[model samples]
Target: MANGWAPDGAVQDQIDDTVKDAVLRARGMMPSGDGSDECDDCGEDIPAARRAALPGTRRCVACQAKRDATLRSVGINRRGSKDSQLR
Candidate 1:
């Protein structure tokens, strides 16, 4: 059945677009490998272990946590199908 403003498939398309936008935005947020030891947000020292684990890490653990918490995630298909969304 079609909704007033959106067709049946149109809602799915909007969802897909939203997912794609979220993925692109997340990719853009990936920390770059600038080799900076200081946290970009807090200016704290980036631990050696963290640096080793995340080669391209630019934020310290605390800063990274803050960023992660602040990060916004959109509804994306986990199973590549709408069945998952129905569950």
Candidate 2:
């Protein structure tokens, strides 16, 4: 069932797109290091515990937190194209 004047599958497609976008965003946010226990951003020694908790972590926890905050502010785009129109 469509809501308002939207098509039947529009809402579902939006949901799927939102999920995909989130997955992509998460992948991009992932650390891309070789578990060196070195902070890629500041070149400081990363703690062993931190390395274990977040494998492949490139940035320090503080830097990563700051980056995450910036990402949250941008929000996500939900435009629907024909490719997205298929649901």
Candidate 3:
């Protein structure tokens, strides 16, 4: 049963929505159009393998890893208090 008066599939719907949001966010982050031969950040040459694998990759592995590391973490409060949800 769902907590409080939420509908039968509310919990599952929340989970599905969270996954969908993450997928959309990832897709938005993906490179579009043609990839360059050089890393956008460091100007180092992007490997052919990465360009082929990702299709539109631009940054080298190291630069990309650094950029990924700099991204802020997003947390879902699955266990948020009912009072918190009310606000």
Candidate 4:
């Protein structure tokens, strides 16, 4: 039931790849170990609440927010479609 030239399961494969990519991206964004008591970026004390909530956090709230903003600004599209590449 694939459209055009795609073979059967092609669409499903694409969907699976997209989902895998998203999962990997999310995992990469998460901290790995116990969160530090101090911000890695600014040397400020990382709040206990934040450390408790995000176990691997390395930055203070403000630094984390800034880093998030910066990351958001650099948009990543995992679709890898020809149309997307053209743009």
Candidate 5:
């Protein structure tokens, strides 16, 4: 299975790298430390129940949902090659 210009195992290497990047990104997105009393994004009070339940939340429900929506709209392109850029 010789790729025209890629060396052997290059495809698998790309896949592995993509998976590793995704894992690192997911870990970075994890909440950390004690939950803040106020929303970090909107300056609104975070509910006691939300803080208690999530333990490390920094945003109110509305702000958190908005942040999540923004994140969801931004897709990560692991394969940042020129071909991928063209597409």
Candidate 6:
């Protein structure tokens, strides 16, 4: 069933696009490339095991935990909800 101004699959397309965008965003957050021997935030030495385990880590566990703690949810509702808009 087609809705006003949209084709049959328009809503589904939006959902797929949103999922794709979220996947891309999460992938971008992951560390990549040849990482560091030390923490990027602190001067603490990154362990060999951790470096090998994560493959591309720049921060030690403690510093990374602090950084993760400060992260906030910035997601926006693309579905046009009044509650989301108010926030």
Please tell me which model should have the higher lDDT, number 3 or number 4: 3
Each prediction's TM-score versus the true structure: 0.58, 0.63, 0.83, 0.72, 0.61, 0.71
Pairs of residues at least 3 apart in sequence or in different chains that clash in candidate 1: none
Clashing pairs in 3: none
Q: Which residue runs of candidate 5 sit more than 4 Å off their true CA positions?
A: 42-49, 72-87
Worst 10 residues of 3 by lDDT: 72-81
Candidate 4 C-alpha lDDT tens digits along 4-86: 78788887887887778778888888898766888999999988888888898899989988888887533445556798799
Better of 2 and 5 by TM-score: 2
Weakest 10 consecutive residues of candidate 1 by summed lDDT: 72-81
What Cα-based lDDT does every candidate model obtain? 0.75, 0.76, 0.87, 0.81, 0.82, 0.86
Per-residue error (Å), model 2, residue 53 = 2.3
Model 4 lDDT, full chain set: 0.81
lDDT per residue (tens digit) for residues 34-79 in model 2: 8776666778888888888888877788877777777753445476
Which tens-of-lDDT digit does each residue in 1-87 have in candidate 5?
647887898878878887887888878887898779998888989999988888899989998788877886344575577987998
Q: Is candidate 3 or candidate 6 better by TM-score?
A: 3
Ordered by TM-score, highest first, the candidates read 3, 4, 6, 2, 5, 1
In terms of TM-score, the best-performing candidate is 3
Please write out the lDDT profile of model 1 over residues 21-68, one tens digit for every residue: 888987887766566788778888888988887778888877778878
Clashing pairs in 4: 35-55
Question: Total clashes, candidate 2?
Answer: 0
What is candidate 3's local distance difference test score?
Answer: 0.87
Residue runs of model 1 more than 4 Å from their true location after superposition: 38-44, 67-87
TM-score: the better of candidates 1 and 6: 6
